[model samples]
Target: MRDGELLAFAEEERFVREKTAVNRYPAHAVKFCLEYGGIDITEVTSIAFGWNAQKYAFVSGGSQMEQFYDSLSKIYSKDVKTLASEKEILLRFQPERIESTLFQALSEVGIRVSKKSPTIQYFSHHHCHAASAFFCSGFASSSILTIDGSGEETCLALWEGRGSQIQITERVELPNSLGWLYSCFTEYLGFRPYRDEGKVMALAAYGRPDTNLERVFDKVTGLVESFPFYRVDPNYIFYGRHSYGRRFTDKLVTELGAPREPCFEVDQVSADIAYQLQKRLEDAVLSFLRHTLAKRPKNNLCLAGGVALNCKLNRVLATEQKEGLFEGFFIQPLSSDAGTALGAALLENYRIGLGRHVPLKHLYWGPNFSNDEISGVLRKSGVKYNRVSSVATEAAQLLSEGSVVAWFQGRAEAGPRALGNRSILANPTSSRHAEAVNLKLKRREPWRPFGSSMLLDAADDILIRSEAAPFMIQSFLVKDSFRKQIPAVVHIDGSTRPQTVTRENELLHEILEKFRDLTGMPLVLNTSFNGLNEPLVNTPDEAIETYLGSDLDALIIGEFVIKRNGTSPSDLDS
Candidate 1:
C-alpha cells in the first residue's frame, strides 16, 4: 500500500491451504507482498496492527475478568481458582508479545528483522473496519458502520467519514453485539458459527418465519422505537458457561428448543429460527441506519465488519435507501477480520499524508501467473492442451453446451467470491449444470445457489433495481421476466448475487458476450475454484490439481484449454 496504491494483498489462508489459518502469523502473505513489491523487510517504513491491545485491556476491567472466570467455571462444571496476578498477566496485552511472535514467524520464512526494526502502530479493530469501507468508498462524506463478533471491548461502531478523516460517532460494547447474536443462532442451527454464517443466510430463504419465532427473537434481542439500537439480552449470551463454550445459554435453548446437532439435517424449527433471526437483524440494522441518517443526513453509506458480508441485509439497505438519505452504498469486499489488515494500512497511509480518495476499482490484487509460467506447469504435468487464440471464446463455447469449465486467469480475487478469475464456470440457464456442479463437483450443500457474472450492460434487463454490483457482495431481485432464464443462478427467493463484468474486465466480459451471442444469455454461473472447505487455488499447480480432481469437463488456463477424455466433439463445436 505504498503511496496509497495497493501493490499486493492476499489472505494467508490462500497460501497455507487452511481455513482462517487461526492464530498463525501471516508470514507467507507478508513474504508474498514484500517479494511482489521488490523489497526486503528492512525497506518497510512502518508496521500497523489492527488490534489496540492496551485499550482493550483498559476497557475490560476486573469485573469483566471475574465474569469470564465465572463463565469458565460453568463450562468446566466445577470451581476453578487462579491468582489475580495470574489472571491479570493472562488478560494483559503486550506489544512485545506480538513483536516477538512476528519475528519468529518471519524468521522461519527467512526474513530477518531486528528487535525494534520498524515503527509499530496499533489501530482499533472496529476503527480499522470503518476505515477500510469509508476510505475505499471515495465518498467525500458518509455514514459508516462496523459490526462484528468482538473487537477488543467494542463489538460495533458507527462513524462519520470526511475526506481523509473518520470520527467515531457511537459504540456498542461486548454482549450487545449484533454479530454475536447472529453467530449464536448460526451455531444453534448446526452450522460453524463465524465460518458458516453465510450458510444460515442461505437457509433462511427456505424457512417460513412465524409469529411465535418472531416473538421469541424480539424477546431475545429487545427492540425499541428509538436510539441506542436494539438491546441483545446478556442473559441469553454472556451468562454462565454459554459464551465460552457453545456461545448460548440454557435460557436460549429453553426459548428456542434444543440446539441442532452438527450432523442433523436442517429441520423446520431451525430454519424458522434462522428466518426470524435474519428478519430481526435486518430490521434492527435498518432502524439504526435510519436514526443515523436522520441525525446526520449523509448521502453515502459505507459498511464493514462480518455482518456487512450479509448480501441479503446489504440488498435490503440498498433498496430501502431514499432520495435524501443514502444515495450510494458500498460494502468492503473483505469485510471480515482479515479486512482489518487493509483498514490498518489505509489508516496509517492517511496519517502519513498518502491517503487515497478514490473508489476501489477491482479486487485482482493477489498473485497472478504469466502465459509462459502456466505453459511450463502444463508441460511439467504432461497434460494434453492447446494454445488457442481466444481462451474466452473456447471457454464460452464449452459452457454453452452444458459443460462445466475451470477458468483460471489473471490475478486471483482477494476476497471470497471468484469474480471470474479463479472460478468454476457453468451454463447459468441449466439447472442440471448447477446440480452437478454443486453436488458432484464441489460437494457442497445442494441448497446453496451459485452466483453469476453478467455483462454490465445486461444488468438492467435482468435485475429489478439494476445498480452496478461489481462485487458479489449485494444481492438483487431477478426480474420476473429474467428469473426463468437464469434459474441456475437465481435463489429460491428470486434474487441473484451477480458480479457485473464491464469491458475493463476484458476476458470475462468477452466470455459473457460470446456466451450471450451463442445461448442468448449474458451471464454464466460462477463459483470459487476450490473443493468444499479449501481456499481458492492460488497457483497454477493447485489449479490443475483441482481441475483433475473435480468433475469439471474443461480447464482453461491462460490461452490454453484442457478437455476431459469423454467431452464430446459436439460440445466443443461452435
Candidate 2:
C-alpha cells in the first residue's frame, strides 16, 4: 500500500469485473477485510474507510454517490447486466443502501448478519492517500502533499509527518483540482479518462502547450492566473458529470477544438489536447510549489495521490528541489485508492495507539512463498532449471551479456511496481533491448522509458554525485560523463527513477554487486513483470504465465534459473 501501511487491503475493482465500479461504497472491499483478517464479526476494534464522503460533500457541496453513478455508467456503459449485477454486490456497501443490496449477499456467503452500521471510521480521502505514501517512504519526517482529481472535496492537501505523527498544514479542495482538469482533457482527447491519463502524460513530451488551460477552468471555477494547476476560486470546484456550476468552460473547446465524445480513437486532436494539458499542469505545479515551499522549504518532500503517479511532473519537482531547494523526495508506490486503505488504518493506529509516527524501512509487505514451493514450480513447469550455486552471479553474467530475465522471488509487492522480487531484469547498455521487450513481447508504449535498480553506494559516483535515492520515486539527472554506459534506463530528458539497492534488499543487492563485477556498472534496468492491464504475478503459475507469454529470455526464481527455447539466460532472442 502507499508507504507500506497495509497489513491488509483490497480494491472494489478486483471483486467486480466492471471497468471501474465507481461511486459504490466498497462492500466487497470490506468483505475481503473480514476474510483476510480472519476474525469474527465485531472482533476487530478498528476500521478505516478510504473516503470521508460526508465531510467532503459538506466541504465541496457536491454529491458523492451521484457522481459515482454518473461516472460509472458512462465509462462501463449503461448495460442492464451491469445494473443487474449491482444486486450481487456485497452487503458491506452502505451509507444506508447496504441494508437492501448487501444484506442478501452476506446471507448467500453464510454470514447470518443482522443489519447495523458497519464499524468503518473515515479519514479524508487524499489524507489517507498521502499518509499511506509517507508512512511507507522510510522517512521519519517530510513535507507531505496529496494532489489528485478532487477527493471527497479536497484536491490538494499539505501536511508534515514527524516520527509517527502527521499534521495537515494546508488543503485545496474541489473545483480547484488539477486531477479533474487533466481528466477533462483526457476526455476531450477521446481517451478513457481515468485509464488513459498516463498516455496523455506520454503524449505531452512530444508537443508544446497550445490550448489555454486557464481559459477552460475560468468559466466555472474562479480566476485561473497560474493556468491549469490551481485556480483562485473563492470555493472548490466539483467537475463530476452532474456538476452544474462550471469548473470547465465552453470557451476552452472553442480555443482548442470541439470537445470529444467518450471512447473516440486518439487522433491529432487528442495529442494536441494532451500537449496543452501536460504543459499547463507543470506550470500550475511550479506555481503551487513557489507558494508551498515558501512556508515549508524543507529539502525533502513526500507526495501521494493518483496525480502524483505522473513521472514527468515528478521530474520537474526533482530539478527544482535539487537547485538548492528540497534535498530529498519519496513518492508512494501505491499512490491511488487502494493505498488509502493502508493509510486510513495506519492513521488510526498512529492517532489512537502510539500517538507517534512510524518510520518506513522497506517495501516487501506482501505474501511470500517457501523455497520448497519455488522448487515445486520449476519441476512442474518441466523447464531445464536448477538451483544454482550463485544465482546473482549467474543472473548478472547473463544480463551483462544482454539477456532479459524475469526475476520472481519472495513476497509480491503491494502496489503497481515491481521493486525487485517481481521484476524483469535487463541490461542497461542499450535501448533496443527495452524496445524489443516493450513492442514485441510486453506490448507497452515505446515512448515510456523503464527504471533502474542500482546499489545504494554505487549510485553516488555514476548516476549522480552522492545522490542517495533509495526508492524509485524522484528522477535523477543522468550524469553527462557516463550517458552511454546505461542507455536502457535513461529517459529522453537524461534522467532515471533510480531504486537504490541496499542491504535491506539483500537479494537485490547481491544481484547488483554481481552485475557491477561482470559489466563494470552496478545498475540494471528493472520493470514490473506483468504485461498490460494484468496484476503482478503472485503465484508460481502466474510466474510461469509471464515467462512463457513474453519475449523474456530467462526465468529466475530464488536460486533457480530457467531458460526459454534453449536460449541461454545470457542472450537475447537474436
Candidate 3:
C-alpha cells in the first residue's frame, strides 16, 4: 500500500453474484491493487479488511469463527471424516482460515509474493463508512453521519472529521436503523429486499400516499421499550428472521395490505409504499440531523451509508439545508458497502497517522483502458468500427446529430454515478428524447430522470449548487431559466442530481468541452451504462454488448467509435 493508498473493495461486487458474500473475500480486487500499484507484497506495510468478524458476525460462544466452521461442516454432511477431525473442519471455515486461500487466488492472477504477507487487521464497518464520506468531503471539520442496515455492533454513527483525523461524536446501535425501515418498505412493495430499494424510490413520485404517514410512523419510531429507535430480538438473526429482517415485519404485513408478489407488475400499492418510505426516511433524517446540528456548530454535513444513496431523501435534506438547515452537502458517491473499502483504508491511515488527506475532486478512480486496449478488444471481437484520433469530438458530433451514444471514456467510475466512463450520452434539449430512451435503450421507469453532467464552469449557468456537487450527491433547483433547455435531466420537482465536471476530471471535462463546442450547451444527458435489469457495464465486453443491443446510434469505446448499422425506428417500413 502507498502512504495513503488504502485499496478497499467488497466481496459481492468482486464475485459479481453472491449474498452475504462476506464469506468469499476480495482476492481479485486485492490482486488488482497490488499489481496496479506495482508494489511488492513484502514492501506493503499494511493490509486491512473492511469487515470485522469480532464485531460483525463473531458470536460470543467463543469466536463465532469456530461456530461458523462447525455449522459449515454440516453442509458437507457426507464428509463424515470431518466429524472425526472437528478441529480441521473448524480451521477450514474461519475467514482467517482462508487467508492462505486469498494468497493462492492472487497468485493465480499473477500476483505472487511471499507467504508471510503484509500486516493485516480489520476496521469497524461504520468507522470506515464514516471515513469514506467525511474525509473525502473536503471538510476540515464537519459532523459526519452514517446510517445503514447494520455494521458491526452499530448501524448509525455520528462523527467529526477534523483535519486528517476523525472523532466519533455519537452512534445508534444495531436493530435501530432508518435504512432497515426503508428496506421494509421495499419488502412491502414486493421488491427484492436489498436490491430493489431504488425502484421503490423511483415509483414513489408516481403515486400519492394519501395515508397519514406521520401517524403510521408513530407505530415504531421513538423507542422499542429499552432500545433506541428500534430494537432487535437477539434470538433472531439480522434484527429478526434470516431470509426476512425484523419480527415486526409480520406486524408490518398486518398493518399494510398483503405485499405484492415479485414478477407481479408494479401497481398503485407499490407506488404508495414507495411514497411512504421516502416520506418517512426524510422525516427521520431531518429529526436525526436536527438533533445532530443542535449539538454542533458546523453547517456542513458528510453523508454516507446505504441510506445516503437515496437521492430523494438527499433532495429533501438539500431543501432543508437551503432553507438554512445545513450549510453544504458532501455525500460520498460510493456511500454504500462498496465504499467501506475506502473507509477501511482511511480508518487505518488515521489510526497510524500515516498519510496526507487527498480531497476527492471526482469519482473516476476505477480501472481505465487505453485506445490500444479498446482497439485490441475490437479486433479480437471482430466488431467493425471507425477508430478516431479525437474520440470526444467525434462522439459529440454524433450526439448533436441526435444519436444516442454509448460514451465510454477513461476509467470506469468508482461509484454508482457514471461520472465519466460507462455512460450513455444524449441531447437534453427534448423530453421526448428521454421518452425515446425509456421506450428503447434504458427501459427504466419514465419517472426516474436521467442525471445531468455539465462542464464545471457551466454548472452555475444551468443548475443550482453551482460549485460543490462534484460527487453528484445533492439535488439543486433547475435554474428556472435553463429548465426548458434541459428538461430531460430535471425531476418533476424541478430538482436534478448533477455531476459537476472539471479539469480535475480531465477526460470527462474534455468530453463535455467537445460537446459544448458542438452544441452551444455545456451539459450532456448521462445515465448508467446498464439497461433496465443489468448491472453497470464493468468490462469492455459488457459495454460493447450493451451498445450493439440497444438503440444507441454509436458507441465511442475508447478511441474506437462504432457507428450503428441498423434501420432507425423512424425508418421502419410500416
Candidate 4:
C-alpha cells in the first residue's frame, strides 16, 4: 500500500493452491497484483524480497558431499534421508545462489532483469515481520515485537516505531527461539509443526498443565533476568535443522512420554503436554514484553510472526495485567511467512518515502470474480445456477433454515483464515451443526471447533471484549447467556474466535444483517471453504468442484446460487 491506500496485495498460495509457498517464487501472485494495480513490471519502482540471504554467506562452504552426509545423519530415518540431504544442500548454497536463481525465476515470469532491476532490495526476515506489524498498526508510535523460527541468524526482535520510522532496540539470535520451542512440541504431538500449532493450542484448553511438564518447559526455555530473552536448551530439542523429522531428542521423550502418533486419539498426556508448553510460552512472552516495555515505554504494541498466530497467547498479551506495559495491541492478520511478502513491500515503500503510516482496515486484497466470470464457469461445468437479485438474502435464508452454504464472493482472503469471502456458513444457533459440518461436509476432526462471523455491534454483547477484533486472531469468552444460543460456534471452554464484520465488509455485513433479521441471531458459524487436507479453494472452478463434491446444501458465488436438485428454499427451515 502507498500513502495508506491498498493498491494490491495477495498470497502466492491462492494462485498455486499450496498451503505454504516457502520455496516457490510468487510469480502468479506478482502478476495478479500488478494487473490489479493496472501497472506493468517496468512501471514498478522497487522490489524488496522478504529474506536477506547474505546473512548466511559466512557459513563454511566445505565439501558439498560431506555436508550432505551430515544432513542425512541428522534425520531419524533413511527413507527421507535423500530429500533431507537435498534440502540441506540447497540451504547451504542458498546465500550465494539465491540472487541468480531469483533473477532467472523472475525472468521466466516475464519480469525484466539486468544489472539494475527496479532497484531490487532485500529485507531481513524479522525486519519485514516488524514492518508488517508496526507500519499498519495505526499507531503513530508503537512497541514492535517479531518472533518466529530462525530467520537468517535472528529469531526474535524488539523495536520502537515513531512517526514512520522504527528503531531496533533488541534482538535474540538463533538457537534461542520461542517459535522453535513451540514447533518442537508441535512435532512431538504428531501435528505438522508450522501448520498445526493452532491445533495444539485448542487441545491445550482440554487438559490441565501438569507440574512436571511445566518444570521441564521452564528448564528447556530458561528465561534470563538481566536480559529480555530466553535460551532454548538444545539438549531437549534440535536447534538447527531443515527437515520435518523428529526434532525432540530421547531426553524430551523421557520427560514428556512417547510422541503421539498422527490420527491417534487425543490422550490426557498429549493434552497436558500441549497445555504446559502453551503456559510456558505465555510466561516467556509476557516476561519479555514487561522487560522491553520497561526499558522503552509504549502504550501501543504491534506483533507479527508465525508465533503471533497463537490466538490464545495473543489474548494474554492484550489482556494481561502489567504495570507500565502496553494498553493497546495490534497483531498482523497474516502473521506468518506468507505475510513476509507484504511486510517486505511495506518496508521498501517506507524506505523509499512512498508509504504512509496507517492502520490496516481489511484483508480482501486478493483476486475477485465478476458475475460474468461466475456465469462462464457454471455454463462450462454444465451446472444449474440462478442469478439471484440478492445473494445475501438467499444465503441468509439458507442459514436461518439450517442448511450449510458455501459462500464465495468478492476477493479471496490473503491469510490462512477464510473471513467472510471464502467460507462455509452454517446456522450458529444449532447445537448439532458443528458435528454435522465436521463429519458430513468438512470431514474434519470432531474436536476441532468452528469460528464465527458476527456483526461488529453484536460482538460486545456476545463476547467479552476490550478491543475490536476484525481478524479472528484472538479468542474471547462468549457471554454466558449466548453460549447455548450460538452452540455451534462456541468451544468447549465457552470461548469463540470471531471475525467481527463492519462497514468495510459491506456485503458480508449485509448478509449478517439479513441473517439477524430472519433468525434473531447476529452471527453465523463460519469455517474455511475446503475439505479435509485440502487448501482453501482459489478459483471459481475449485470452488464449484468442492461444492459439488461435498454435502453442502447450496453454493453461492457472486450473484449466483447453485443448489442440489432436491434442495429448495423450503429446505432451509426444515
Q: How does each model score on lDDT?
A: 0.82, 0.66, 0.68, 0.79
Candidate 3 lDDT over 1-574, as tens digits, reads: 3777534332334235233344455666666566667766778767666667443233567564455444544542323333344445344445565567767766776767675676666877788888888877777777788888867556788888778777887888544667767676676566666677777777777667565654455565533332243442322222222223332244455455455664234476566656766776776667767766776675688888988888878877777777886786777788878888888777787677775565676666556677777777877877667755676677677777777888777756676677767788788888887886776588866677788888878887886656657767666778999998888888777877788887877766877888888878888888877766665676777788777788777777776767777322222110
For this target, which candidate reaches the highest TM-score against the unseen true structure?
1
Candidates in order, TM-scores: namely 0.92, 0.78, 0.83, 0.90
In angstroms, the error of model 3 at 17 is: 7.6
Residue 116 shift from truth in candidate 2, angstroms? 9.4
- Per-residue lDDT for 177-233 in model 1, tens only? 889899888888778888899988988887896998877887888667755667887
Candidate 2, lDDT over the whole model:
0.66
Q: Count clashing residue pairs in model 2.
A: 15
Please list the residue runs of candidate 2 whose C-alpha ends up more than 4 Å from where it truly belongs after superposition: 1-43, 55-94, 97-118, 133-142, 161-165, 209-229, 232-253, 258-275, 295-300, 324-328, 382-384, 464-466, 567-574
Steric overlap count per candidate: 0, 15, 0, 1
- Residue 388 in candidate 1, Cα distance off native in Å: 1.2
- For candidate 3, the TM-score is 0.83
Candidate 4 — which residues are off by over 4 angstroms? 1-5, 58-96, 107-116, 239-244, 263-265, 321-324, 566-574
lDDT by residue for model 2 over 1-574, one digit each (tens)?
A: 1232344445554345233455554566566556655655545555566777453232243356445544545643333433443323322333345344544555555554544534657777877987787776777678888888767657888788777767888878544678877766676565667667877776665554443554554442332444233663322222222122233333344545566643223354455556666766777777776666776656468888988878778877767776855666777766867778778888877766633344555656555667688788767877676667677777888888777888887766655567898888898888877875675356766666788898888776776644665556566777887678788898766778788889888788999998888878888988878766666676677788778887788888876777765644443222
Q: Each candidate: RMSD to true structure?
A: 3.7, 6.7, 6.6, 4.4
Best model per lDDT: 1
Order of all candidates by TM-score, from best down to worst?
A: 1, 4, 3, 2
lDDT of 4 by residue, 290-367 (tens): 777776545688899999999889878767633447766889988998888788888887787777765689888888
